[model samples]
Target: MKFQDYKVTDINLADWGQKEINIAETEMPGLMALRKEYSSSQPLKGANIVGCLHMTIQTAVLIETLIALGASVRWSSCNIFSTQDHAAAAIASKNIPVFAWKGETEEEYNWCIEKTLSGSDTWAPNLMIDDGGDLTKIVHEKYPGLL
Candidate 1:
């Protein structure tokens, strides 16, 4: 995706989030190893992953690892309060669409989920990763063709 494609809380928070995401990367050896091992082969090269989870430093690490292993991703927070704006910004800075922020109403939360599930003209997800059932539920109820 292009750099201008995402809708995060703030693009300016990228530097702040990058430092933490860097620290988190150091603490995640398993993913690092996987990235080193499989990145060249790019087993997930064709993957278009839609992820709905808590947006945090840890989540950023996972998403980046997925990218390193060759998966294009879109993301959203499962809960309104669980999203870290800086983290969302960081992901979006790398041209990965991440729709989330620190606070949201029920409607906003659902909207973010829908954004991850159904992105801009350039994105069409072929896989999904969900924390709670909201993503799955919405796919079944709304975008049944994704099934």
Candidate 2:
């Protein structure tokens, strides 16, 4: 609930986080299978996926699936209260780059979204997946090339 830097390599914590992801997978059978298939196909190779969604188990699975599909993903929470602490832990465990947390103030929330939107030229997100259109608007206004 507080601000702290957690690296994905924190083995003990990451394992617990990974377990959370596994649990999420159980409830997301279709996405799990899709991730397996996409991992093999790599359809989104070289693509960056910037997502603005609730940081929950469901979202964690989707993030993993996107990586498995060969995407470089940057994820942030759509709502301050919607972050699943354990889900974020699990994602951080996998060493996935994520920025968002529960109980974020408006300033912190906007800062997270801004940070996620920053990217290298080619690696900048070509596709924006958002629940409320925040990411698209940010990119369109700040980094028009990504649009």
Candidate 3:
């Protein structure tokens, strides 16, 4: 896991993150219900899900859903500039490992993707949820077995 090569601020933005998470939760009733019902079932109990998407209300819904379904998630921004810092905060507030933020430098963007893939070393995702296909491509090229 090249995680050591990446530099994350690792600071707490709790209040800001909480606000975004709350708002996303309100808009995602369907995913939320899935979380409530299936969480205990643990259908995805040992699964790992690495998602590359914009940090937004919709993405928050998806990540929380996957977690509730018993999957460990590593989230990253798809487009470098599209990440909403507040939304990233929201996801991070829940203590879901997120590796993206607004106005990230190119190095940060690549590093985040590297971190997401690193989580797969132990157990590759059974399924990947991606917005722009960057994560998918990386998995294919670097760890084709996941595909």
Candidates in order, TM-scores: namely 0.94, 0.84, 0.81
Model 3's alpha-carbon lDDT is: 0.74
Per-residue lDDT tens digits for candidate 1, residues 4-112, read 7577778999999999999998999998899999989999998999999999999999999999988999899888899888998998888888899988889988988
TM-score, model 2 to reference? 0.84
Best by lDDT: 1
Give the alpha carbon lDDT tens digit for every residue of 1-147 in model 3. Answer: 222322223435546656767787887788878888888898988878888888766787788788878888888889888876766766665667788877788788877887877753465567777888888878878888767
lDDT values for all models: 0.89, 0.76, 0.74
Provide C-alpha RMSD values for all models, in order.
Answer: 1.7, 4.3, 3.5
* Model 3: lowest-lDDT 10 consecutive positions: 1-10
Q: Tens digit of lDDT per residue, candidate 2, span 29-56?
A: 8988888776888998988788889988
What are the runs in model 2 whose C-alpha is more than 4 Å off? 1-13, 120-122
Clashing pairs in 3: 17-89, 17-90
Clashes of each: 0, 1, 2
